[model samples]
Target: METSQITDLKRILANSLEGIEDPIERSRSDFCFYLENVVHDEGPHALTDYIQLADFHREIADTLMDDKTSFLLVEAFRGSGKSSLASVAWPAYLASLNPSLRFALISKTDDQAITQLTGIEAILRSAEHQRIFGDLVPHRQYYNFRAPWSEQEKVIVRPKFSRFPTFLAAGVESSLVVGKRFDCLVADDVIDLTSSFSPTTRNRIKHWFYQVLLPTRDQRWSKVVVIGTPWVADDLYDSIAKEMAGKSFFKHIRIPAIQTEQTDHGPIYKSAWPEVFPLTNLNRIKSEGHFAFQNQYMLERYDVTQSILKKEWLKLIQQDYIPKELTILQGIDPNAGRVTGKTGDMLALATVGIDADRQAYLLDLVYIKGDIQEQLLHITDHITRWNPKDIASEIEATQAHFKNYLEAKLKETLGLDITIRGITSKNVPKPIRLRAMFDAFIAGKVLVAAHVNWETGDLEPLPSLLPFVEEWISYSANAPHDDALDAVDIALSSVLEYGGRLAALTIPSEAIIIKDRENLEKEEEMSEEDLELADLLEKYEKNMTGTSVLANPSRFFQRRINFRGLNL
Candidate 1:
C-alpha cells in the first residue's frame, strides 16, 4: 500500500529465499515458499495460499527432481491451479536449478504449447526473477550479454553459459529438433474432451504419444509428467493409468473437490479452498446430476461401476412366468420426429408384465421405422399378440397428432377399436426420466429375458439374441439413439409409479396379466375385425427383429459402417 511497506515486503521475501541459491533445491525444499516469496504474480493462480496446493502439485515436482518416479500422472480438478503450478512455475524453477536440464513442454496443439511457453518466458524476465534468480544478462552491456539467449515460442533459454535447454515447447504431433535430447517432458492439456471424442483422433493422439513423443526423451535419464483433468473413462490418462499403476517407475496423484469430516461441530464437508468452492456451490454442482460432479471434480467415470439400470442390478428370468393379477402394459414412444430415415425418430415400444409379486419382466420390444400403414401393422401385431391391459404413450405435441392418426387408421383398416392413453409431465427432462428408470431396476423389481433382440412372445422367445445388455453397458450421457431405452423407461415408470423413488419401498405396486385371445376378447368385447386381425397376426408372427426395423441409432450406424466395409 505504501513505499515503506513495499520495501519491507521485499526485505521479507529476500530473507525467505535465504539459503536457497539453486532454484531446484529451493523448489525441493519449499515450492510454496519459492512461489510466494520469489516468483509472485507470475503464475496462473491469482490466490496464492498454497498450503493445499503443495499437497496436490508439489509431489509431482518432487518426483520429477528425485528421479525415483519416471512417469508422473496428475488428474486434478478444474480451477485447482494445476496448470500454473505444474506446467509454468515448476518447470521454470527446475530450469534455474538445472540450467543444463533439457525440458520439453507440449499441449494439445502447437499454438497452445507456444502460448504457454510465452507466459513462462515472461515470468523469467520479471524484476523479482532477476533479483532472486539473476538477470538473463551476465556481463556489462545488456543486449550483448543476452545475445546468446533465444526467446522464441518453440524453444526458450538455450543456456549461454551451458549446453542444455531451459524448455522446448511443441504440439504432440510436432517433431523435436535434432542435436539435443529433452530429459524432462511436461505434457499439459494433451487430451481434452473435444480431441478425445473421435475414435480416430483418440487413436492418432495415443499413437503419437507412444511412437513419437516417447522417443524425444533422453534415454539416459528422462522424466515425464501429464497434467490435466480426466474426461472419459478410457482417455489417454486412463490408458496410462492402466499400464502404470503400482509399478516401480510411475506414480499418480489425484485431488478430489472436498472431504467430509466429523469434528466437535458435527459432520462438516469442506473443499481445499472454501472461498473458491463453497458447500452451496458443490450442492448446485451435484444437482447437475451424478456424472457431472464425479467426472469434473472427482475425476471419476460418472458411476460406471454401478449406474442406474446396470446389468448386475437387473433380475433376469429365462422361463415364462404367466400368473394371475397381472398388469400387462405397453409403453409406446411412437416416432414423433418424422419416421423418414437419416434424421428421424424410430417407433420404440415395450411390452412388460408385472406379476402379483411385483417382479416385472420385459415380454417384448417393438422398435421399427416405416410408413403410417406399416407402423400401424407392426404396432397392432404386438397389441394382438401381447394383449396388454393398458397402453401408455408420451403425449408430446407431435405424438398426440400421431396417436390420433394411429387411432383412425386402426378403426379404418383393421376395424379394430383401441385407445392408447397419453402420459404427460410439465418440466421433466429426459435425463431425469432416464435416471428415474433406475429406481425399479435397483430395487430388483424389473426383469428381462436373456434374449430381447427380437419381438417374440414369452412362450416362444427367439434365440437369435442381439443382446440389449451391451447397450446398457456402453450407454452414458453423451450416447446416441436412445429410442428403445426411452420406451423401456416409460413402461417401467408407468407400472412402478415409484414417483422417482423406490416403488417397492414406498408405494403399493401394480400387477400384470397375461391374457389369451379368448379371455382378452371377452374382457374387451373384440368385434369380428379384431378376431380376424388376431388370426392374421398369429399366422404371420415371425421374429420381426429385422435389421431395417426399429433398432438403436448406434446400431444402425454401426451396421452401415460394417456393411460398407464388407467385401462379400
Candidate 2:
C-alpha cells in the first residue's frame, strides 16, 4: 500500500531467500519474485489473472502449499489450461512457500510431458514475468531448470543453487521405475481416456501409476496430482470415484465445458460446490461451443446412435440412386413367433439397393404382425413392383419354412428369384464393420437417397446403430444379443461384399501382370511367317487390357472418390 510497507515487504522477501539452504536459495528467490512482484500488480512482470486457472485449480494449489492434502485431482475439458495451472502456477506457488520443494511433471507419454514443459518455459519467458525473475531456462539433458539469480545487490548475493530444479519428463508407464523421489509429483493427463478405453492400455497405465508413481514419495509431505479430460465411462475417473467414495484424501473437481441439465434445472447452492465447478461468465461462450452440455457438464455419456449414421448417409445413398432404374434388395431378421407376449422383439425385414455406382441404399422396411406366409407375401408384394435383383435373407433359423415357400410356392406364386444365404457373425468384428462404414461416409462411398423415406423403421434405427456397434464390439461376449446391430451388420456386409462395391473399385496388381503374360505367350506361339502380324496383334491386346485395368482400377474406390472427391 504505502512506500514504507512496500520496502518492508521487499526486505522480507530478500531475507526469506537468504534463510533457505544454498541448494534451494534460487527457488525461494524466484518464488518470491513471482509472488511479491508477479502475483501482485508490481514490477514489469505480473500475472493479470488467476481465475482463468479454474476455481479448483487455485484451491488445489493452496492445499498443496498448506500441506493439507498430498493428492489432488482436477479434471477439465481440453484447451482449459490444466497444464499451466499444475506445472506453472502450482509449482511456482509451492516453491515460494518451501524452497526445498521438488516436483516432477509427468504425462501419459514423453511428447505430452515435453509439450507441458514448453508451456512452463513460455509462461516464465514472457517479457512481463522475465523482467522480475530473469529467464528460467530448462536443461534438456537433466530436464531441470537452471535457477534465476540477481547479481545487482552485494548482500543480495543469493547462494548458488543447483542451476536446475528437479523438473523432469517421464511417461506414465516407464517413469514408474525411476529412483529419484520427488517432494511433489504432478501426473497430468495420467489416464489418457482414449487409451484407457482399451483394456490393455488401461492396465498398463494402472500398473504404472500404482507401481511407479505411488512409490515416488520419500517423505509423508509429498503430493500427487492427477488431472485430465474425462473421455470415457471409466478409467481414472472411476478409480478416483471408487477410492473417494466416502473419504476425503481423494478430491474430485470437474470443470465442465458448459452448463449441464443438472445445473440448469437442478437446485443451486449458496456457495459453490467443491466438486462441481460452474463455468465463469468469461468462459460461457467457448465452453458451450466446444463441447456438448450432456458430455462436458453432466459427465453423462453421449449417444451417437445408428439413427445419426442412417440420417447422414441417407442423402448420399439416395443421391446415388437412379429412381427409375433402382433394383431393390430385401434383408430379413426372422422373429419366429417365439415370444408369448408383446415385450418380445418383432421380426424385421429390410429391403436395400445398389445403384450403378454400387452405393448400398436402404429402400424399405417390412414390419409384420402375422405368420411366416403373411409376412413373406407382404414383403414380396412391396418389392414386387421394383423387380429386385436378389432377396438376401438370413437362413440360419426357420430355414425349412422359407425353403418350402421359395421352392414350392413363393418363387412361382410371386415370380420372385429368391436367394437365401447364411451370414456368419464372425471374422470381421461389428466395430470393424461400423468403422468401415464410418470410413465410407467420411470418404464419401456410402450415402442414402434424397427422395428416400426417413419416417420408416429403416431410418429410425440409424441413431442407435453406431452405439450398438460400439457396445457390440466392447461387450460382445457378455451382452445379451446383437440383433439390432446384426441387421446393420448384414446390410453393410452384403453391400460391401456381395455388391462387390469395395472389391470392384480396388484394382488387383495380379490382374495387370496376368494379362501382360498372356499376351506375351500368345506372341511366342505364333509362326515365323505370321510373327510380325502376331506381334502387332499382341501389342494391341496388351495395350487394351492394360488400358482397361488402368481406366477402371476398382469400382469401389473410384466411385467413392468421384462422389466425395476424396479417396478412402
Cα error, residue 15 of model 1, in Å, equals 16
Cα lDDT for residue 305, candidate 2: 31
lDDT of 1 by residue, 1-568 (tens): 9999999999999999898677645544665657666554433663452324445555655665666788989887777777777788877777766566777888888788877777677667766556666754334454344334444332333355444456677787776534557888889988866565555677888888877787878888888889888876567888889978989998888877876689998987778556667878776665434444666787774332233345564444433333545677888888866533334567878877777666676667877777766777888888878777777787776788777777777788778788877776454545445654554544445656442222432222323212345445556655556667777777766664522232243121111121232345366565565444444333334334323322232222212222332332
Q: After superposition, how far is residue 103 of candidate 1 from its true place, in Å?
A: 1.4
Query: How many times do residue backbones clash in model 2?
Result: 29
| TM-score to true structure, per model | 0.51, 0.47
Write model 2 residue lDDT over 99-214, tens digit each, in one string. 45556778777778766655544445555455544544433444323342211100111234542344566667763337766777787876643565465676676677777777
The alpha-carbon deviation from the true structure for residue 527 of candidate 2, after best TM-score superposition, in angstroms, is 84
> Model 1, poorest ten-residue lDDT window?
506-515
Overlapping backbone residue pairs in candidate 1 total 9
For candidate 2, the lDDT comes to: 0.49
Q: Give the count of colliding residue pairs in each prediction.
A: 9, 29
Worst 10 residues of 2 by lDDT: 149-158
